[model samples]
Target: MSTTTTAPATGTAGLPLADRTSGLVGSVIDSSTSLLAKQTHDIVRFAMGSPAADAIPTAALAEVARTALGVDRADAFDYAATEGDLPLREALVDMLADTTDATALDRVTITSGGMQGLDLACKLFVDPGDVVAVESPTYTNGSATALSYQADLLEIPVDEHGMDVEDLRGQAERTGKTPTVIYTVPTFQNPSGASLSLDRRHRLLALAREWGAVVIDDDPYGMLRFAGDPVPSLHELAAGDPLVFSVRTFSKIIAPGLRVGWVDTDPSLQPLLISAKQAMDTCTNLPAQRLVEGFLRGGYLAEHLARTRTAYRERKEAMQEALTEHFGGMARWTDPDGGFFLWITFDSPENNTEIDAAIDTEALFEVALAHGVAYIPGNAFSPSRRFPDALRVCFATTPPARIHEGVARLRRAVDELAGAAV
Candidate 1:
């Protein structure tokens, strides 16, 4: 009566695989969500770039869903247009009309999410061995998408003002090659929480024009500005330039679970985008698109953004205050005007010179997890395994008090690691 269990196949020993598989680097930031989910203990999560639970307009969404996906609305559950549901596309155009990312319906193609938009852009423009420039601490998913297309990534360093355009030029010069695709988060960049300066934006466009490179402007947080003056999006700056491919998502503003986003490309590329999307998913989830359309048409986004912006600003301040209180002498962090993350780098304090040189944030991750704190190690954001001394902390999901607790736990983890090294 005893049953023998067979071990599942391991590794890709005999399976036919393409060379592109080698470039399929996975995302540690996303894997952390799965890793943390299995833990039974209470962990103060500062890892995922997600909106707070309260930030999601659940009740409003539920009300919208009642109509958007009601039994009477049988078409709501049907497949959407490859370009996008017409109503949703119209709504999106209207929603963005007054914003820095304003766009036309002719250029919009609904995507599964921001990640899909990134993938689509790579699929369209990136050829095998093509040079792709990305920020040093870029969005893991974005860089991974480019890598999946067999792109040769050149990591450009980012400062408080965002991707260093001068360094980008210097690196291209050093390598004697220009990028085929320049991928940038630009506004409130992921991991670094830095926006590309106005001066740099112009320079980047000029460089792209000179190099004939396609600029993948992946901007998911441009509308979340809370602390600083608004900056024009690359989409806005390009002003109908076909070289700029703008990817946007409702995940940050609305809810990630909806998985609804869109790409604003040239009208000439719209047909190709539809073909690409049809080969992939046929179309975006119809119910989700309907829900987003309802949310947008009901005039709920403005109020929701205003409320969340205020809350995020307060949370960012709280996180900074906590960092100052605990690691004031031992660390430095970025001050983002409006975004979900703060980039923290361990520095050489006068009293603790060993910290900057010895402690590796990658190694400290396990210790931090045990201490009931979770943050993405800076190395996870880089393709070249750079930033061993730094990490990215997300303050958007956690409340002020929880943020304080999480920062304290992070400090304890650092102390534990520092003491172990000593």
Candidate 2:
């Protein structure tokens, strides 16, 4: 794990400074490990993972094919308007008509999915050496995007209430790091399932306004609420401004394959994002977009959400009950009102760290695999010892029996680890 070293080029201090550029050629080259990490193949995963639900309203799929092959029309052909098809765009506009009293269509931009929305945001704001604020633990994808851009990330610690506001302010004013944006997943957050307080939401917006830093509202799980009251979106609370944005996707509530997601940003930023969209893929998959367009437009979408929500609510209950019965005080976690995954904090004799601090090491993951269970570790979220003893488990993809079995497997793994120490 030792990294190779390359010393900085040195030139006569009295000589012209710009002449030293030639000596720096090999000094700043990208590392080989950076490339290999990107190429590393991951094992099959079921999260926080699940295949598309059975009730996808298949008639819409057939209709999409008909439209694509020109069986009924020729609209799917040619380079898509580079701004996405009008039908899908309008459908998105209609879908989010409920997003607020202040946000407008001119404020929305289409991208492949929430991931793309975030990538575009990072590309727009983060520059090498720029500071980016994130929840102490955050989505792995988002963190990677910032890091690849070489942005210096400052993590704002979190408690059960969500990201620490005071920590964020201190970082913003820190001498060395200059922050460009604040990224967050406020409701049913990934891996942590921590929801922000409404008061914190208002305070967060005000702080962003004061600091002139834009906030990226990554809320794919907001609508997945299973048992609690709703929190107003950052976009809704912040009013209209170039400084705040929200990224919403259909993946969770509908199907991940659709890749239809939009950003609620200032009107002035729309053209820039649309430009970024054109370069990414011109537009998202036409067939997928059309199928979702049909699905949402035909009016069966509401029923689809209700069906999934009810079933997922049951799964949530099972996860909670299983944790309480087994881990109990040994691990603490939020009973998410609604969302696909639950976050667990392991109370181990040793602190769970980014590497060996976690119980689910290479050995533990293998043990869980053999025991018919699997999960993503807490460190993977931010590569920090934020809570070395924490772990994330997903319940939405599996049925009741599988959920129970997975929890049992996790219990056995924990016991085995403790026994080895004894």
- Top TM-score hit: 1
Candidate 2 deviant stretches above 4 angstroms: 1-46, 49-70, 100-102, 174-178, 350-363
Relative to the true structure, candidate 2 reaches a TM of: 0.83
Q: So what's the TM-score on candidate 1?
A: 0.96
What are the per-residue Cα lDDT tens digits for candidate 2 across 180-299?
888898888876778888888888888888878879888887777768777787777877767887888877877777787777788888788878877778877776677777776777
lDDT at 355, model 1: 61
Error of 2 at 382 (Å): 1.3
Instruction: Determine the C-alpha RMSD for candidate 2 after optimal superposition of all C-alphas.
Output: 7.0
Highest-lDDT candidate: 1
lDDT of the candidates, in the order given: 0.90, 0.68
**Model 2: lowest-lDDT 10 consecutive positions:** 23-32
TM-score of each: 0.96, 0.83
